[model samples]
Target chain A: MTDRQDRKAFFRELGKYSALGLEMALSVVIGMGIGYYLDRWLGTGPWLTIVWIGLGFAAGVRSLYRAAVRSGKDLERDEERRRKPGGP
Target chain B: MRKAILVLLAVAALPATALAAGGHGFSWFMMLPGGERLFYMYAAVFIAVFLLVAAAVVVGGKKTEEMVIPDPRFTLRNLFELILGFLQQLAEDIIGHHYKKYLPLLGTCFLFILFMNLIGLIPGFLPPTQKMNVTLGLALVIFLSTHYFGLRENGIAYLKHFLGPVWWMAPIMLPIEIISHLARPMSLSLRLFGNITGDHAVVAGFMALIPVVVPSVFMGLGVFVSFMQAFIFTVLSMIYISGAVTHAEEH
Candidate 1:
């Protein structure tokens, strides 16, 4: 990557990585909150909570996987940029 | 130089250890009740920053020719220009071709959050971003704007991403997408709130322990943290906006 592109990419990557842990944790909390509300409204005791928490965990892992894939692609791009020293 | 840094780090670590022990002593204006305190604090900071920006603009606007020529010395106008220039570059790189349209929002977020965070470094003034409501409010605005721009760009197709690639996967993908989307704002708010509150608390704790030289190190750290948190928030917002606006082309 060119110097400017490299800096930009570094900032973007930093933001993405920093947010990942908090995002995953919140994903679970949001899922639980949604599940709890649905359970309360429908008078289903624990079933919805169970299901939603499961869904939330899945969502958390899914996002982590997506970020992993993105970083992998980014690394590949960086490698390509390195191979062609002068090209942007 | 290494020994000096190590001593600085050791001084910094003392306060952090104090932070862990959980004794903080800092007071703001005691007139307001607990619930409305953050609101008033945020408003005061908002007005102060607004006035500062307005003054800078008015002064800078007075001489149109001078605006073109760079200032010989560091000045408020130069600082503002530097920040805006950096944000412009960031927007261009992250948001791509239509980056100009989003510069105003990104710039506002950067400046507002940066000022709010910086205010915490001053003794007796708490940063509003330390409050959950303030940070969450800011995050929600970014959240709403991201979707609004996405909808404007892609119409109804923007919602289709939530439904996954295949029709059969919609049930699974929809909830996961919703959870993840909701998490973005929550995480944004939480990270800002936690960092500022923690930083402020550490500074306060150190101030209570020893009034003189010790607190300054943590205050310096506070300054760095404030800039970092603000930058991270803006960068994330830019990433989100770019993702929303450009997702259509990729998928």
Candidate 2:
């Protein structure tokens, strides 16, 4: 491939791949944010915050897993197509 | 749909009303002549501009794709193709073939929020998004609309989504679902508001310090942040909407 085309491909992959990480991180952060506030309001003294953070981590990991599987399927599809005759 | 629109507008307008009505007490000094009235008008004006552009695009563009327009000028048709085309790609990328029906809503949203965010970079104007009321308003519309789409797609069985996998966990699961679901809008609004407000403040701060050079730097950053926030908001909204419909396919 040409250098310019390679560079464009690199950036596209970079952006596409990093979005999963960002989404995962944001999920945990959102969980923590909600947990921290709920703790403060309910006077749970960190228990709620702890629980919410845990939930947040679960949510993030769940999203990451979803993303990984989705990308895996896409890559497999691409490979299958490439193995086919007359494929791009 | 009309009633839903009215409700969303009313919810969106509530904070502006309270701010204007109660301004005599706390924010008397900060109040401009028109006050929150003017604050809300910026969004109104954006909506008006959105309608105008859409109308122009609809009129200017040919109905059929076969009609050729090579490198068309900076006309509404070109602008329409550029934005709508990108949004179409975005929706399809995120949600697959289920994307077309949502294009108009998502397209309008991206265009409106992107412009609204950029407006603050210009001097003597505030981005409607900086106000929690406006952000909340946009979020509420998405929140309700996504649920509507979810229910339509999945049937009333969608409520099982709130209930956990095991039936016994419903009590614990429901609240978590509600809070996390509610947090979608909270985060959506606050993230946009916080980023834009912080960016605007820094730009204004720098503009005050050295009106000539430094603010331009912040202005450039504002452009980047504005686009990123718009993108994040749009993509997240798409994810939430699609998740409601396609939960079974993912796992």
Give the alpha carbon lDDT tens digit for every residue of A57-80 in model 2. Answer: 766665566556755765565567
lDDT of 1 at B44: 47
> RMSD to native for every prediction?
5.9, 11.7
Q: lDDT, candidate 1, residue B180?
A: 90
> lDDT score, residue B92, model 2?
74
Q: What is the DockQ of each candidate?
A: 0.77, 0.17
Q: Could you say which candidate leads in DockQ?
A: 1
Span of 10 residues, lowest total lDDT, candidate 1 chain A: A69-78
- In candidate 1, position A2 carries an lDDT of 66
Worst 10 residues of 2 chain A by lDDT: A4-13
Query: What TM-score results for chain B in every one of the models?
Result: 0.83, 0.79
Mind giving the per-residue lDDT tens digits that candidate 1 earns over A1-88? 6687778778878988998999898889999999999999999999999999999988898889877876787678668867985777
Residue-level lDDT tens digits of model 1 in B182-241: 998998999999999999888777777785578889989999999999999998898788
Best by TM-score: 1
Locate the minimum summed-lDDT window of 10 residues in model 1 chain B: B20-29
Residue B121 in candidate 2, Cα distance off native in Å: 1.8
Per-residue C-alpha lDDT of model 2 across residues B132-210, encoded as one tens digit per residue: 8888888898999999988888897788878767899887676556655665676677777888889877876665555
